[model samples]
Target: MPEVPRTADPFTAADLVLLNGTVRTMDRAGTTRTALAARGGRVLAVDDDAAVRGLIGPRTRVLDLQGRCAVPGFIETHNHPTFFGLTLAADVDAGSPPNATIADIVARVEQAAADAEPGTWVRGYRYDDTLLADDRHPTRADLDPVSRDRPVCLQHVSGHFCVLNTAGLRLLGIDRNTPDPVGGAIHRDAAGEPDGVLAETAAFAAHAAMPKPETADLAEAIGLAGDAYLAAGVTTVHDTGLGLVGGPAELDAYRLARRKGRLRNRVRAYLVQDLFPGLSGGELSPVEAGVAGLGDDLFRVAGVKLWADGSLQGLTGCVSEGYACAPDKNGLLIFPQDDLSRRVATLHEAGWQVAIHGNGDGAIQAILEAYAKLGLDPLEGDRRHRIEHCQMVSERQLDQMAAAGILASFFIKHVYYWGDRHRDRFLGPERARRIDPLASAVKHGVTFGLHSDTPVVPVPPLEGIWCAVRRTTRDGHELGPEQAVDVDTALRGYTSQAAHLGFEEREKGSLEPGKLADIAVLSADPGAVAPDAVRALQVDATVIGGEVVWGGAGLDAAPAAGPAAGGGDGR
Candidate 1:
């Protein structure tokens, strides 16, 4: 890869100059430099302090970094922006004590219901199944005391599912006779009544009944979510699933965020396939031209997103072998092969980059086959199709990804958070090593991006980096240390590597000339920190496109609200 010039004149007139920091550019060759000069949100020049000072003029703002470590702004490849934003607006703290159980959750919901006016909904999130002492989901009986006049829905930790109280189920008219939707499950008891555990699209539908936020509310939520990302040193986020309900909703949110200049970081929003309704299956124009890849070097619609399989916790992740915990079951397919193939083929043929969710080995193989079936040449620039959460890929699928030029966004943090649970209950210990094979992806010449599936986990790219670098489980056991990447490699996966997946490498990711001036100042040098100390590292500041979004001084370090809570989680 040839190096692009930083700017037309990086060492000349600029809007700002950040000096005296360790600048980790994450460039093509993986090198670090000092002192960056910026003009109108683009990196103009990078060199030593005295040299960069020459570019600073009377109007230029100079920020002395005081030798803090800097890296390219973080880019998260998979997240639920709209859902996260909405959850944030509800303003309920879900990351309570690890001992917080179903009864505690019910109490919290009752309190929220009391505070809400009649007919207004009360929603809560971050309910962990393992922590529930009853080992059962809460039902309307559990929450009826909260408010029968108002509906309440609490999303399970895995966004793939949720448990809606009777009021919610009744509001939606989901009764004993309501057959399961095409791609979802409604958990029922021996009495053949709704058990309130709605999985897949069904769970999503219950929450959908609640009023969608207004454009202004959405705009605020985006800012809140974006600020959260920036605070964690993230400069860009690939919103994996956008336009879930429809284009108008998500588009309005992202557009409003950009128009208000509230989006400090770039968002590559992958429009959800479910949104492109009633198309005749031909070449489609960009979803909405002006805003598809819009904004002040801050946000863009990177591609189209599709989910091929279910989630690990839900026991729906499509695996080649039966789950260790459920020997007779091989997991569910969210989209059967033929339908998924048609969807991928249609999207790719229409010139839109495609990203498919494939968590199980079987799902990964299906994705690889679809990419091969396309028969497109690899030399094509920007085709960069991605496999989000390539968690359980096989050796053959690894070869197929390399051969087909498929980029992978591995949810590596799963190895840390769920490794023990997965090994003991889901994928047997022997098959666990094959999960999120980072080293294999590297050996096969596949470009792998790392991410925290926010709302599934927190949206910290450093935690993603830490997971890839350590390859250890939560119990302090080294699952496969041989698969661990060095700090430089893991850092690239979060920065430039992630940018390439979103096709924004030219505009962001690296601090090279002409790239957006999105960079993060760290509390310690990642390279110098001991491998185990990676997760302990902190952010000093987060600058996106030449503007400071989060200044770390005296910052409130509390965890953000909602089920996708953040913490060590061994990542």
Candidate 2:
């Protein structure tokens, strides 16, 4: 024969192939390619020419990217997917909607009452009293006009506070006599009467008191949130806590979603520390339980989440120095230093990852001190513990965290959402500039991830990257120029670094042979574009395990569910 040509073998060809795109591997080698081939939900090969062609056979689905930009799927290290879905289904937007004030909130509630069945609860969310005309939290009297017959619940955007009408209060059995729950207090009036404002665990209790949707409905809503994550170009998320979604039933909710084929993205969950309390009421609770290592690859409870302090924007963060607006208040600590350290040590010694919400320098320092006492050095053991919202920390604290081998995830969105307020009042300009110091963290050689902390902000990685890179406030002023990071570092915060946070680096977060094929296709190369236009870049496709999950030109797909039973990578 004069010539012979080889073709892809039918038996071993790839199931899917993507070609002609800029692929950022995000691996140790920092490989870049224009094509990829996948089989059995894992990457088979990454190449550009004959290598990719040989993987495509008669049964393969070959996608031509036509020169777009593709990177590891955006991984949200911290967020609230199920709760985001639940809020989308049940809560009204009291802030952004036509209702921006308590009066407007009343009007929206009245409208909800018009068609709602009697005795059903009506809920609204994102009600910012600071922005309201009255500049005060809504009280029961304000909600009574809407419907005294039906209970009304309004959640502050921070997810840390809630306002309820009188009926709602009665439903929760609160009449000022209900002393504050441990670690949670009810905001009462000067006369010692409940003012309809519930803080911390009290807020959680009141919100949990609402009638829950059926299991199937809740699962569906959770699925919808997964879909939302995919559409937003996020293929993995860390559901930071589960107290609001059915308590221990939260385990059931996520399990059911995965079993029903509703879960379309990877989830590593953390249960509330309350659910796994080492001690209760300053003493151990009679009933003992666990959530660590629960579920499989699709859903795994990897850690316990404890709140050391409240939100910085809410003026409840435990700061080393007092707030400028309220110099008398230094913010609330959810757990006393001793109790928090004990709980953290218990979990750390048990080999479970502990994720503590630490927003202020005080909280960060306390958490690091607790880690230091553990004595199980990272050089000797697996202590990839996390600090959520490590937004306010000193340089000394960063060095301590680095030495302790602690990982951090920052709520960088705050720079944009509440920067001016933080600068002008919360921390004042000097302390404000250090909030979420991306550049400083990078300089200190500490690994960290960026987050939205959803319900507080949307799950938009591009925006987060923008926030980290620009540090721009709402009014176009750069919050902290020195804190801003470059484009590549910002991208890593969402990709390779995020994988490290979830301990999934070996499997996802990179396009490499033998790894699950998870990739995000962008309309334009994020690095090649002007810095300010990064957020403006649109998602073209999101793939998980070689299958299209979102933005694939009308492709509706689910994530790759590996083995039914697999251990959590608290690696």
Tens-digit per-residue lDDT, 1-571, candidate 2 = 1111124676897877777778778887778888888898888988884568777655566666767788888889888876788777864677644555678888887888766788888877777766677877888888888778888888888888888888899988999789998657788888998988888778877766777666776787789888878877888888898655667776677778888888888888877765764443333333333446766656777777888888776777889889999898887787777878888877765657889999988888888877887875668876789899998988998888887788999999989988888898789998988899989898888899999988778888999999999999987888879999987888889999888887778878788899888778888778888989999988878878777766666221122233121111111
Collision pairs in model 2: 280-283
lDDT of 1 by residue, 302-322 (tens): 678888788876787888889
Candidate 1 global CA lDDT score? 0.75
- Stretches > 4 Å off in candidate 2: 1-6, 208-210, 277-291, 554-571
TM-score of each: 0.90, 0.92
Tell me model 2's lDDT, rounded to 2 decimals. Answer: 0.79
Highest TM-score scorer: 2
| Candidate 2, position 191, lDDT | 93
